[model samples]
Target: MSTPDTLAFRFFSLHVVRTRRLGPSLVRVTFAGDDLAHFHSGGRDQSLSLFIPAEGRTEPGVPVEEGENWWQAWREQPDGVRAVMRSYTLRALRREPDEIDIDFVLHGVGPDAAVPAGPASRWAARAKAGDRVQLIGPAVTDNRAIRFRPPEGTDLVLMWGDETALPALLACVEALPAGTPVRAWVEVSDAGDVQQVSTPADAEVTWLVRDESCAEGSPMALGAIKQAELPPAAKPYVWIAGESGCVKTLRRHFVGERGIERRQVTFVGYWRRGLTEEQLRELPED
Candidate 1:
């Protein structure tokens, strides 16, 4: 049974309603459930902990508990019986049907792919309707997981993301007010992964394809951003997410090189290049 994880967050039992291939490297999965009626979000880069069934199981095995001890209980579960947890961003939410969309990056999914796909990628690639999953998500709007906050008096918005962060980046862009000045860059595995972004803001977006220029494990956007001639702004807010190392590099460039205040730049490492989320969580923070 689902329980409250925190004051602002609770567990929701959901099942896949449908799946659609957005591109060669992206798939959108829509989930619906009665429990979603209470689910709410501010929705820019709202993060959620999604638990899918382990291999050969139909439903995820998670411990039921009250308060924060649920984390320890879950960690103590047997590896094979334990649910596979992954972090994801909410792409779209619909009120009429109480459905939410999560865009999954189908990294290294095919036979000819250069790298091997992870458990979440494999699960998403073959996901079908009625696949049960669980999520720890927001129960109220303006929760802490949504990280794309621009402080008051932000005259310019700058953004960068890789394929993994593309969904969140697009959502943030679309949410910006009309006439807002923005410059954004997104990097993806291939040109086929480029998306059509509809935003009311005066935004300039650049798409960088890894297949064309960047080798795996290399930072693609840093060089382009280094040469960019951004419009003058008294105050700028920068949001960057993607590969951890790349994100750090960009953060340093903005704060150290461009003289932007550290507080004005928001950076998140959506994923590390060589580490899984579980492995990443085990390491000490910098």
Candidate 2:
């Protein structure tokens, strides 16, 4: 009998067919699987969970099967199951009968990027064409009211992020409207972390380097943002992601103190400064 907690959603097994270094800190892993054939597209900025097989496991990782017992199965994984799961955004979901590409940001050793190194980074570093990893989620948000789309009539779009948010920033750039004005401020450890991103829109991109002395929450990006002046009433949308505290401060300056409408900005706490993903998940929403 299927467990009561088992979900009715379709699950798929995918293999990492390719890996590419788009930038010093960004790695794109392309996955192909029969399971992705039914994946629903249209989630421009949605998040997904990647289930990586624990080191040395040969068989593909399994998803919690459907039914009431599904929840039980999740709660009762065999001790030492060789699987590591990490949350990442769906950079692009192009469907070609049995293939999908998911890009992950390779957040290397950083005090601010506290999430433990997992299969995603490991696979990106050494995954060959035949290696496989299971994909677990496109976690659907129930409130359809909260959808994401590049704002229209936008004269300028300002995007800023630390390494933890590189994937989303790339995805945003790729989805931008042609000829739309945009600017990106990316903060990285050093010049080695730079990556190339293609955008249909015109953009002035800047990279901020932390040359071994700056702290995680330094105001480098924020300082750049403050100095930048936009076209009058250009309907600019500000997207910022990174350390929770830093993001919150930026949010206040843009939306609260600066009088920008709430809908004109998107702020995400990709990961907290000192908490693991597991712990961050349990934190209360602000």
Best by lDDT: 1
The lDDT for every candidate, in the order shown, is: 0.89, 0.67
Residue 239 local lDDT, model 1? 98
lDDT of 2 at 146: 23
Against the hidden reference, what TM-scores do the models get?
0.95, 0.81
Query: Candidate 1 residues 95-183, lDDT tens each?
Result: 98899999999977999888889889999999999999989999999887889999999999999999889989999999999999999
The candidate that achieves the highest TM-score relative to the unseen native structure: 1
Clashes of each: 0, 8
lDDT of 1 at 241: 94
Task: Give the range of the ten consecutive residues with the poorest summed lDDT in model 1.
Answer: 211-220
Q: In candidate 2, which residue pairs clash?
A: 3-67, 3-68, 3-69, 4-68, 4-69, 5-68, 6-67, 54-82
* Tens-place lDDT digits, model 2, residues 1-286: 1221113233457787787776656667888877776555454556566667667775444545533454346445663564565666766666555566666556553445645565557566777788877665432333221234557776778778777776677777778778878888888865877777787888777888855455647488778778877666658788888778888888888886667888988887778876777677677766
List of clashing residue pairs for candidate 1: none
